[model samples]
Target: MLATTIYEQGDHRWIMFGRDPDKAEGIIDTNQYLVISGEEAILLDPGGIELFAPMLSAVLKYVPADQIRYLFASHQDPDIISSLGLWDQALPNASLYSPWLWEGFIRHFGMERIRYCAIPDEGLNLTVGRIQLQFVPAHYLHSSGNFHVYDPKAKILMSGDVGAALEPGEPPLWVENMSQHSAHMKTFHQRWMPSNEAKDHWLRRVRQLDIDIMAPQHGRLFKQAHVDEFFNWFEQLSVGIALR
Candidate 1:
């Protein structure tokens, strides 16, 4: 797994870990984000069970295991937070912030130690040390109960599966070209995302924020102008293809 600092400004930093070349075959690659704000830190969508060892090893390279004070899952997907059991043992006192709808379901992954902080449907604001983060509602774009994290200070949005793509091998960390990248993301969004109404609602809300980087759980991240290009493309595409 490769760990890269996507954003940094003194004690406030956003480190993305993914693109693991040694990952087992047939398992989808996923990105895990770590946010550090002074003495506090949060791990977002910590990947599946197969990734726990490498993910933990990669994360410990920056912040100590104990300093990971928080965990945030966009929804209750196995790929999204199946490592909960392992993380529970690692960050015993850390709290997990996830949608209220999935508290009971997510707990099945094993929550003997970590406390669950359910995020309401309306979303909520959380402060980690010196930085303020927003849990933005993202229901039905893919999952029925989902939320994305937005950091206003870094102008970064951890969009979960909203911008995910399924590629065969390791790809570039950031989307270098929007037109070419659209092909990679098209099928995943059309099939996985089950609602056009939900997509519109999410687009409307996300457009209101000033975002510089759009970080998704799978595939490449979008930066600057590519971020706007993504909105323009996604806003017009019709999702829920399986129903048709």
Candidate 2:
């Protein structure tokens, strides 16, 4: 199904679209994000080849395809990068923004299509008119060459699949129940994060941030209350203090 929703929170607007939330197993029904700034327009995690047309169509409502300045991928997953080739062709002038480690991975797909601007371990900064972006590092959340994005201005953390929630059809954009979302979050972390040490490190690193929104790829956009409550539970689960 084609589920799309547009939200305007304060100064920024978000256009979100993807497959039904509940079908998220080993599947890549992840939602793609479109971050528009005064000077630039960017598409985040534009994967899932099927969603490209709608993603662009949704984007066309705001700006021209050529106006896109950047494509940001939190990691190198097929659902995240598969359609990048199409984007590369569409936005010939736009450049890809990703973690440096993903440099080879993006090239592995085919380098001539787009220009890659690899970010560092700590993160990189991007400017869209006056808005600045800080790419926060969440090493090995689901992959070694992974990272998270923090938009201080928007108080958003586009945290890949680390804090995801899957519900069959049309899952709510932001989960309201910390307990319910907590279960799905736990299963994902435990199965994907096999190294306890790395998990702990990523947890502590994340805790250092002052977040108001935890926008994961799969679930509801956890707002302030749920952010604090969910993190508290996630911290416990990460430390192995809880079980299935």
TM-score of each: 0.98, 0.87
lDDT of 2 by residue, 85-159 (tens): 777678878888888988887766554767899988877778764577777787777777777777777777788
Writing each residue's lDDT as its tens digit, candidate 1 over 198-220 gives 99999999999999999999999
Report the Cα lDDT for candidate 2: 0.72
Model 1 alpha-carbon miss at residue 204, Å: 0.8
Number of colliding residue pairs in model 1: 0
lDDT of each: 0.94, 0.72
Clashing pairs in 1: none
Candidate 1 lDDT (Cα, 0 to 1): 0.94
Decoy 1 TM-score against native: 0.98
lDDT of 2 at 71: 86
